[model samples]
Target: MTDVLARRVQASPDATALVGVGGAEWTYRELDEHVERVAGRLAALGIAGEHLGCLLETRPATAVLVHAAARLGCVLVPLNTRLTPTELDSHVERAELAALVCGADTADTAVELSVDVPTASVDDTEHTEITVLDSVSPAEFAPASRDADDPAVMLATSGTTGEPKLVVLTTENLRSSAVASAFRLGITPDDRWLDPLAVYHMGGLAPIVRSALYGTTVVIPGEFDARATLNALERFDCTGISLVPTMLRRLLAAGSLADSLRFVLLGGAPASEELIERCEKRGVPVHPTYGMTETASQVATARPGEAFAHTGTVGRPLLDTDLSVLGGDGKSVDIGETGELVVSGPTVFAGYYGDPDATARAFSERGFHTGDVGHRDAGGRLWVTGRRDEMISTGGELVAPGEIARVLRSHPAIDDAGVVGLPDPDWGERVGALVVGDVTDAETVRNYCRERLAGFKLPRTIAFADELPRTASGTVARRVVRERLLDNGD
Candidate 1:
């Protein structure tokens, strides 16, 4: 892949590249300069072809370094600031990070990782002087004696599987994914995106990489609050935004978003059909997508158009991408038949970083097994069923809790929902429900289900809570909720 920073700056050096929520806007020219300066500093520090843990907020310096690392062939290991010190330490050790670059706000967390591997504070960066990169070009940084297969980034996984794992990202994989996302979302120079996602995830990385690729302005959030995000839409004159289902649901329910919006790319989790319809009626210009860290960002997306009909279904695979469904018995399932969603393409990661066991488990000679269960429709739209590990077997029948949750959440009363199979004496396992809302206790919810679903589908027990458990990435940790319900008295 071509050097992203070099290419974009060469094409549109005058365009605005980065904008912080608090202050500071760096143009493409300025961004390129800072990247060279920092990489020069890193070369002085003797950090090359190695991992460096970065614990900074969304800022121009952090972004510049991501490219600088690519220029030097150094692997960037971005540590999530939200993670506890213990979690942070685990990642630092795992990535074998040689240094830490932190934003002032997250300096304490960075210190926890280490006091030794020199920490550079982004708050110390001065936006007063624009360092012109006139003489030094990114083209001067020739490719070292390394293949494209080498790791450029080491992004930590959400740990939904077992422990939080580090994903080795190659320049080619990230490059392909960003190009694919532009086509998937119809990104353009005029399309200014208000991004509220955490920089640790691919959702956040895609925009930064895209900014360097497309020369578009991406407004970063100082902090994430639904109301603030809504306010910024008009304040920043943002054309589009990326948000998970929960974030969008809160924004829509709060009724606080500014008037002008082109498309709200809602993904990270499949949203309720009601949520999509509400946006449609209100002219929110909603576009639901399907992606994960493994795929870089989005593999399939449903843009707002008449030709695109399915709402819940994640649209067709992007250009030069491939997807298939493996049935429960391990064969290609027919359209409409549920199976594991397997993705194989240029954008797909080669394997999990430093974990051969995980790499082996995730893929075979066939393709990269996503562990997500989904099936294609007549229109070739993929409707995600649930995760393979999330499947609950009650008696002899396999039950996908996501199916039950989708049906239950459709009711106006239910705000948030999760379904799990609980161990039972006679049936071996019985369905369980965890909901966040006012209406319906265990019996009432069970009776409500009886009206719409079979007796077996009804939750034997219903639990009410202020909120469902969520991973750092904002996906509902269904397994965590199940364990919580089973272990703690509810």
Candidate 2:
């Protein structure tokens, strides 16, 4: 395929491409210029065809760099800004990042994470004061011709064992995702999508890429404040948006959705049935989508009409995608039978970066094993149960119980720890911990973990025990821990 941004500029040069909620706007032509400028700066640092880590918040600059990295043949790795220096260092090393680009807010963290790699700073505002980029001119760079199969982005997802694994999505995968999403959601020239999710997430970055391809507009609301997002919806006259369950709940609590909205593409975490019913009653068009970072963005997305009728299903697979529910026998289960979800599509990611064993294990004869347990109806719609693994879904972020257990075990007084997700009305599931240690209070354990883990990964509740329940093979019995933690009650 031709350069995504360049092709968009050719088709709609003067069309509004990127808009800052109440700040600034850039046409496709203007965005192309900015992309060229950023691409040149990256080339000045000899960053072509290398993995580039971007530690940035959701803003226009990040969107510009997304296209710029594509133009320069760089595999963009969007770093989670909430991660601690210690946590981020491991990911940086694991991804083998060649260089790092940071916004002003993240410059210090970039310095800590890029000890072995080169780092640069960018002025995210309209004023273009760049650090490493200042020494180079746009005239010095030429856009590289990229193959469709070339790796475009590398995103980190937690493995079953709690280690961070990088998933590589190619150019074709992203393009196919955008096309499939448009077929389901429908795109228009006037469609302005207000995005509040972080660029580090596929949910956030997908709109930026999809908007370019469709020659529409993506509005950055800076961050997801319930009131601010609602105001932005009206202020920008946005037609569509993407949100996780928590954000949508907060928005419903704050105020009514804007009249200009057509659809809200909900994913990232499970949306409570109550939340979906509320939206349906309120005339809010909420589409429940089931996807992971591996699929670029969407696998199955229930449209507003289907959503109102079905209530819980995540709808049928996207166009050009195939999904199956597989039992322990490694065969497709009967309809309505709960089994592991397996997905096959043009949108499926290339593989986990630099890990052949993981790549092999992630796929089978049928398709990529999703590790999520769900059943499909006769209509082919998916109803998710829970994770086949022990990953916790709190808010929209996926937290590894093993990761939290590791941090708890690091404490001086703690002997052993077991972590699990407990059901909650608000956050889909909240992180709960069972500690076998000399901990007098829960705050002490939480305070210790706060230093080592991100806020979302920290346990919300702590229960003390003599020892953790373990299997005969000496592994912690996560189901028992979940049950026991629920029995203690926060």
| Model 2 / residue 292 / CA error / Å | 0.4
Query: What is the per-residue lDDT of model 1 for residues 1-490, given as tens digits with 9 covering 90 to 100?
Result: 4367877888899898777776478888888888877677666556667777778666556677677777777778887888887777777877777777676577766656543456665564332221222222234434333466777777887887678888887878887887887887778887778878777888876777777777788888667787878777877778888888888888887775666577788788878777777777777777778888787778787776521356566677887678888876678999888899888888888777778998898886668888888888888887887889888788787877877887777777788887787788989888888887777467667667788887777777678778889887677886877886687524
Give the clashing pairs for model 2.
none
List model 2 lDDT by residue over 1-490, tens digit each: 4378999899999999999857589999999988888888788778888899998899988998888888888889998897778788988988888888887788767666534777777654232333555555554766777789888999887433567689999999999999999999988889999989887789989999899999999999896799998988988889999998768978998999999998899997666566777898999989999998899989999998888888778899999999989988999899988778999989999999999999999999799998888888888788886567777879998776645765676676876677888988999999999998687588888888899999998898789899877542134667788888888845
Worst 10 residues of 1 by lDDT: 127-136
Instruction: State the TM-score for model 2.
Output: 0.80
Once fitted onto the true fold, the runs of candidate 2 whose alpha carbons sit more than 4 angstroms away are: 124-132, 159-161, 390-490
Backbone collisions counted per model: 0, 0
User: Ten residues in a row with the worst lDDT in model 2?
Assistant: 123-132
Go through the candidates in order and give each one's C-alpha lDDT.
0.75, 0.84
- TM-scores, all models, native as reference: 0.91, 0.80
